[model samples]
Target chain A: MSENSGSTSTNIFVAKLSSYIDLSIEEHQVIEELTQNSMAFDEGQDIIFESEKNSSAYLLQSGWAIRYKIVPDGGRQIISYLLPGDIFGFRESLFELSDDSVQALTPVIVHCIPAENIAEICDSHTNLSLAFTWARAREQAILTEHIVRLGRRNAYERLGHLLLELLHRLQLVEKAGNSDYFLPLTQEVLADTLGLSIVHVNRTLRKLRNDLMIELDPKTRRLRILDVDALSEATGYDQSFLDQNEKPSRSPQDAIGFEEK
Target chain B: MSENSGSTSTNIFVAKLSSYIDLSIEEHQVIEELTQNSMAFDEGQDIIFESEKNSSAYLLQSGWAIRYKIVPDGGRQIISYLLPGDIFGFRESLFELSDDSVQALTPVIVHCIPAENIAEICDSHTNLSLAFTWARAREQAILTEHIVRLGRRNAYERLGHLLLELLHRLQLVEKAGNSDYFLPLTQEVLADTLGLSIVHVNRTLRKLRNDLMIELDPKTRRLRILDVDALSEATGYDQSFLDQNEKPSRSPQDAIGFEEK
Candidate 1:
C-alpha cells in the first residue's frame, strides 16, 4: 500500500513522537515521506526470524506484533508487544544479529528505514533523532515493567497490569478510546506473555469479569476496563512510567550537542 | 580513589568497549579522563532512587549493584544486575524521571558522567558514541534474556541460566576465573531475581551441585561451575546474546552519519 501525506499511517507516528518533541511541518512531512512506501504481513507471519541479520529498521504502521523467543522446551515467551507507531528491527544497528524474532499478531503493515538511513536521518534532523531515542528508552522502560510483573506480581495482577499498560500505550497512538481497545490477544497468547497456563489465564479473566473490573468480549475482541482507577490501584499499575508530558527544556540542537543556529 | 591512565578500573572499561569497537590510544585516554573522578556507595545504598531526577550517568567502576522495583504488596523484583563496566542513570537524557531504583549489592565505586556530557561526548567522538550505543543494546539483550528466563524456564533452568550469565559478564571484566566468581547474591536475592521462593532457590542450587554441575561455598561466597558446557546445555543458556566480538565494518563516521575527513 502507498500512503500520501497526512495519511493515518504516518499521522499515528507523528502523533506518538510529537508527545516527546515538537516537530515542525517540514519534519512532519519528512516522516510522512519515510512511511510513504509500505510492506505487509499476514496474521501469524514471522516478520523477523531469530538469528537473522536484519539490516533495516521497521515502523509498524498498522496492526500488532510481538517480539518473542522460544526456550529449549519449545515454550514461547513474548518479550514485548509492538503496537501501531512502534519501531522494531533496529537492534541490528549495533548487534548484527537478533536472538528474538518478531511475529505479526494480526495482519500488519510496516515502513522500512534502512540501517544506513538511520544515521543520516538522525544527523540531519536532531528532533527526530531525539524522538527515536525517546522511543527506545520508552521501550526499555516497558520491558523493565514487564520484568517486574513477571518477577513479583501474581497472575491476577499480571493480567490487570498488562491490560492497563496496553490501554495507555494504544491510547497514545489514538488506537484506543476511553478505557477500551480492540484486543487481539487470545488466552493462549496471554498465557505465553504472562508465563501462566491457558487454564489459569481463562480463570483469571473470568475472575476479573466477575469482579466488575473489566469487560472483555471474545467475539468482538474488545476489552474495556470498567474502572481504570480501581484496576490500576488493584494492580499497582503506575502510568507515570509511561508519561510523555515532561519534555526536556533544551532545544533539539542543545539536546543532541549541536550549537543553536 | 584516584585512578591513573592504565589502572584496572579504567582498563576493564576499555577492555569491555574494545570488544565492541577498537579505540584509539587518544580515545582510551579520553575515557580515562572522564572516569578520573568517582563516587563511592556502601552496600545496600541506593545509587539511584525511584522517581528521582538524576542528571548524570555513571560508569560502574567496582563492585556489584542491582536495578529493582518494589511491587505494591512490597514484593521486590530485581530488574537486572549492574556490574563493573556497566553504564546507567542516563535514562534522563530523554524522559526526565527514573522509575526503577539501583542499589549497591556490595561496596561500590562509580564514575559520574553528567547527562549533558553524554550528548557532547557522543557528538564529538563517534567511536565512543557507538560504543555507548552498543552498551545500551547489550543491556537490553540481557534484560530480554532475563524475561525469557523468568517467564519460560523452570527453577533449575532459571538459576543455571543466571549463574552462567553472571560468570560470562564477570569474566569479561576479569572479575571471574575460568568458570567461577565471587557470587554476592544471597538466597533471598536469588529468590527476588529469579522469581522463586528462597527455599526453592536453595533447593535448585543444591540440585545443581548434586548433579555435578557446580560447586558453592557458602562461607567463601564462591561459586564454581564444574562443567559450564553441561550446565549450559541443560539450561539452554546461550551466551551469544552477551557476545561483543562482532564489530560492524563501517567507519565510525559512517555509523553515526558523519563524513570522513
Candidate 2:
C-alpha cells in the first residue's frame, strides 16, 4: 500500500465521506489501503468503455475523468465529470452492462475497488453502507442540478453555472482559491457537456472574458473567475444542493406550498 | 393496514423491488404495513418542499407527481416526473433538507414512511437494504439519461425521447399499450421539461404529429406513438439504462473506449 505514500491519509475520498459521517480509524485505514493499490492512466486515455462488464468501481484519486456516451452516427455527449474523490462504476454495480464510457481528461490515478470488497465492507460496516448511500444521493443531487442547467439555462448562464459548480466542488478538496483553479477540460469537452458547438463555446467564453465574468487561459488551462458576484448574478447560481446537512428536524413552519421550502 | 384493501399482495413498491431482488414473505408484509396508511393530495399540491428537513420518504401509490426546482424571479424546471410506483424524498433521508420540491401533477395517494421505520427495516434486513440501494441506483440511471436528453438532443428529439421513456416505464406496471400511454402533463410542463418555450413546444409537437410519429389527444391526455420504431430511430432512444439486468456473467466483449462503463 506504499504506492500512494504521499497522499493516502488526506485523500479526497475521506474528505467526501466525512461530509456525511464521521469515520473510525479502521475505516480510514481501509480507505488508505484501498487507494494505495491503484492504476495510472494518461490524459485522453479510455479507462472504461461503454457496454463493458464493470466488475469494479473506480475511485478517482487524482486528476479528472468524464462519463460520456457516443451516438451511433458518431456524435458524443459528456454526461458527468469525475473529480478527485469522485467514484464511478456505481451504476454498473447496480446493473450489468455499462451504459457509458469513462475517459481520463488529465493524467489520473484511480483505485479500482472490486465488487467483492464493497460487499464485504458494506456487509460488515453499517456506517460505511450509509456513507456509500449518501455519496450516491449527492451524485443524484449534482445530476439534478446539471439537468436544470442543460434544460433551462442559456449559453452564458450555463457557462457561469458550470464554473460555479466546479469552484464549489474543488472547494471541497481545498483546491480552489478565491477565484482560480486549474481546469484541464478542453473547449470541445465543455461544448459536449453544455450541448453547444465548439465555436459557440469559444464565443461564449470570449464574451465572459470581455464582460470580466471569467478568465480562461488556454495555454495554461487555468480558469480564474474574475467577478464571482457578477457571474453568479448573471446565472442565478446557488450552491444549496451541494450542502450535506443530513440532520432530520427543523421548524414545521417550513410552509409546504408553491414556494420552495 | 385495512385501507389498502385491493392490492396488498401486489403493491407497486414490492413489485418494483421484486424486479431487482427476491423479497421474502416477511419483507412483503413489511411493505404492506408501511403503505396501508396513506395521505391523499389533490392535483397541483406540493408534496415536499426544497430546503425543508425531510422526515419521511413518500411513496406514490396512485396518480402522478413531479420533482421541480423553482428558479429565482419565477421559472420552474421539471427535473423528474414521478410515476405511480415511484418513490420520492429519498434525498431527504440521506441529507437534511430537500434539494427540490415534489408536487402532485394529478390527484395522488402517497404513503409516508418515517425515517425511523426505514432504519428499522434496513438494519434488520440486509436484502431490504440492498433493494433500497438498487432503487436509488435506478433513479440515478434515469437522471443520467435525462442529462443526455437535455444536453445532446434537439427539441423534437427530446419530446419523442421523453415519450418513449414514459412508454417503457409505464409498461413496467402494465399501464402502457403497444405504443400508447396516458400522459397527464400539459404542454407547459413539457416545454419546461424540454428546455423550450411553450410556443416552441407546440410547434415541435405539431411537427411530430404531422410526421405521423405520434398522436396526442389533448382532451383525453393520451399519447399514442403511431410509429414506435421511427420515433426511436429519429430520436436515438435506448432503454438499456432502465433495465434491471443484474446478472453479472456477461461476455466482457462489451465495447470499450472513451465512453461510460
Candidate 3:
C-alpha cells in the first residue's frame, strides 16, 4: 500500500523521498506545489544536451527519462534512467554547462524548478536539503553499482540484476503490489545499457523466460519478475547499496578516511 | 613544466581543482591548512570500512587509495581510485553509513579534514563549494565511464582505456614532462578492477607491451605510454568525460528544461 495520503501526482516524488528519509509538512507542501507545475514530452526527445545553459532542474512527475553520453564513434551510452518522482538538474546549480544529455524513453511529465528556487528552498529548509542530498547520494551509489554490473557480472547475471534493480526502484515510486511494471525500452536500448549486443540481450531474455524467472510482454511493454529472489541469487545482487539510511545505525570499523565507494 | 611558485604540498590538490576552475587565495589557504593536518598509512590498510561512522574525510597528500565494495561471496569491486590530492569522506555529511571501504595501495599520507570543516568552508565560499561539487561530479562521471568499460569494451580496450585514464589523472598532479607514471598495483589488483582473471590481465599486458603501444616494468611498477595517440585511437579512449567543465561554453540545444547529463 502507498504511504501517501493525497493527490497521487503530488505525492509520488515525496513518497519516494520518504523511502529515504522523513520530510516535514512544509517540505511536503513545497514538493507537492512543485509537482503542480509540470510539462509533458513524447518518447525519444532530448530534454538536455551536451552544453545546455539550463538554469532549472526537473522532477519526474510522470513517465521515464534517461541520462546518456554520445561517444566519438557516435555510440550512445545510457548513464542512468529517471523514473517518476526522480529529480534532475540540481547539480547544475554548481556548474554552468551540461556534460551529458537526457532523452525521454517514454512519454514523460516533468516538474520544472529553477536552480535558484531549489537553492532558495534548501537555504530555508534543512530537511529538504537533506532529502535532496540523500537522493544524490543514492544516485552516485546507483552509478557505482552499475559499474560493478558492467565489470563483473556475466550477461545473464547482468540482465537479472538490472531487472530486479529497476523493479526495486520502481516500487519505491509507484509499486502497488504488482510483480510487473512497464519498461518502455527496446532491446537495442537494453544492449546499450548493459554493454551487450542486441542479440545477446535477446538470448538472455529468452533463457530467463524459458527458465520461468521472468516474463516480458512486448505488446504492452510490461516486465514481470516471476521470481525476484532467484534473480537476486543468480546475480549475487546486493541491495544495501540501493537502500541508504539517513543516519548511522551501525558504523563500519574505520570511519572517515577513505575514498568514495 | 611544473606550475608551482612556492611549495608543492598546497598546490597538489589546488592544481587538481584548477583543472576545472580557478580558486581564490582564501580557498587555497584553506586547503594548505588542511594538508598541515595529515596522517600516514601503511600499505593494505583500510582507512574506511563498509559501515564506518566517519565524521571526517581525507585528502590524499601522498600515495594512493581505492574505494571498493565487498560482496558476500568475498569478491571486491574497486569503485574508484584516490590519487594524491583527491578528497574523500565529504559525502558522509549527507548519509550515515559508509557503503564501501578505502584501502591504502601504498604507504600513504593523507590530509584529514572533518566533514564539518569542509561544510563550513563550502557554506562560506561559493567557489570552494563549486570545486567540491565538481569533484563529486567527476567522481560520478568516472564511475559511469567504468560502467561503460565493463559493459562494452573488450579486455584490450578496457586495459588501454584504464591506463590512459590513470595517466591522464596522474598528469594533473605530477607529470614532470615524463610520459611514464608509477602504478603500484599487482596483476591481482588489475584483475579485480578490470573484471578479468589474473592470467587474462597478464596476457593483455603482454600484448600491449609487445605491440609497443605501452610498456610495463613489473619490478619497478612503472608504466609508460609509448604512443598516447595510437593507444587513444586503438581503444577509442575519449577524454571528454574526464575533462568536465565547471560550466557550459558553446551551450546545448535546449537550455534549462532538460535533465542531468
TM-score of each: 0.93, 0.91, 0.85
Top model number, DockQ = 1
Residues A1-261 of candidate 1: C-alpha lDDT, one tens digit per residue: 334332453366777776667676667788888887788888998888887777788999899999999998889999999999998877766575358999999989888888889878876676777777777788899999999999988999999999999999998878999999999999999999999999999999999999999999999999999999999999999998888656553355433221111
Per-residue lDDT of candidate 3, residues B98-169 (tens digit): 578889999887767776686567666656666667777677777877877776678998899999989988
User: Each model's DockQ?
Assistant: 0.64, 0.45, 0.37
TM-score of chain A of each: 0.91, 0.89, 0.87
Worst 10 residues of 3 chain A by lDDT: A249-258
* Residue range A1-261, candidate 2, lDDT tens digits: 123434565677776776556666567667777887778888888888876777687788889889888875577888888898888786577566347889989888888889878877876655666667776777888888889898888899998899999998888777788789999988899999999999999999999999988888889988999888888889988887887655322222431212112
Q: Could you give the CAPRI-style class of model 3?
A: acceptable
How many clashing pairs per prediction, in order?
Answer: 0, 7, 12
- After superposing the true interface residues, what Cα RMSD does each candidate give? 1.5, 2.2, 2.9
Candidate 2: misplaced stretches above 4 Å? A1-9, A246-261, B1-9, B247-261
lDDT of each: 0.84, 0.79, 0.74
Better of 2 and 3 by TM-score: 2
Q: Could you tell me how far off, in angstroms, the CA of residue B61 lies in candidate 2 after the best superposition?
A: 1.1
